[model samples]
Target: MADELIFYTHPQSRGRIARWALEEVGAAYETQVVEYGTTMKGEDYLGINPMGKVPAIVHKGRVVTECAAICAYLAEAFPEAGLAPTAEERADYYRWLFFAAGPVEQAVTNNFAKFEPSADQGRMFGYGNYDLAVDVLEKAVSAHPYIAGDRFTAADIYVGSAVGWGTMFGTLPKRDAFLDYFSRLSSREAYQRAGAKDDALAAELEAAKAPA
Candidate 1:
């Protein structure tokens, strides 16, 4: 179909974030599960995403990779879902959205890998340092009901996923602000539905690998 939205993801990867966003926007998309290191790196899949990453969406024949971009694109594409931000909310929406995608993601991954940069190196990095990046993120979440202000927007999908996975996986500190922020987001019906779908797919994959 000309308007088909094809979602490429792995149940165990950050694709969960994009899945949630898709559910939020109520987009009718077809899911394609890609395994790590095998089909994910294969020529066919790599042709879709040169980076060989999951959570990519091909909508209306246009490819959108990166969880943040997917969320933003879906929101705009499905305005009836009201996931897009208003003019007043635009500043915080883009600010915190990219902040999570850039600084927070970099800081958390570097911290998890135990690669602390020196002061000089920190200056060269966009995140500065994990501690600084995390501290700023905590304040951002606590300042408002949602990342983009009082209303829920696509920005929350990206930022909330970071906070949710970070705290759950021990990559981020179990701060009250982080926990509270994620708690609110996790309660959304869309989030629950998306999670259930992914969990089921994960179980199927595991079962297929089990000895018959």
Candidate 2:
């Protein structure tokens, strides 16, 4: 039956976000782990993603790539999950989701790397600067219960994943805003399950990398 959803990933990669979406939807899927320095560039997988990226899924004969795209697609595909927003809610959904992936992510990465951009907002990068980007997120998250506000939609899946990973990776500022949001997400059973899977696989890879 092809399992309906084929999660092509390297386990420890951004595929964890898509994996979280799958767990939230309670959708059945088959896992295909691609290893780095090896399986990531495999010929068979190249066609799946032109850039040879993980977190791509083949659902209902359509190939979906990019973490946020996969998350949005899966949420809508399986409406039973209630993780998708309606057309009226599209505005907020797209805003936070893409914001988290784009500006927020960039800022987190920049901060983690200690890359200080120009002080002039117009002269700086897409996220302006790390502090400004984090400030935007802090205010937004503190104001809304969820990314889309009120509902825990797939928007949170993307945003939460970013925040979760950012905090864990020591990228974003560890403010109350991030702590509160991460705590809220961590308490969800689906999140716990998805996180456990990512954690276990990460441990497996670490063991594999250790000196024999």
> Candidate 2's residue-wise lDDT over 1-212, tens digit each?
44778999877689988888989999889988888767778888888887887889999778999999988998889899898898767888899899988898787777777778876752557888887888898887787788777778998888888888777777876888988987898789998898898888888988988999
lDDT (0-100) at residue 58 of candidate 1?
94
* lDDT (10s digit) by residue, model 1, range 1-212: 42499999999999999999999988788999999989999999999999999979999888999999999999999999999999989999999999999998899999999999999999999889999999999999999999989988999999999999899889999999999999999999999999999999999999999998
Please estimate how well model 1 matches the true structure, expressed as its whole-model Cα lDDT.
0.93
Best by lDDT: 1
TM-score of every candidate relative to the true structure: 0.97, 0.90
- Candidate 2 regions with alpha-carbon error over 4 angstroms: 119-124, 202-212
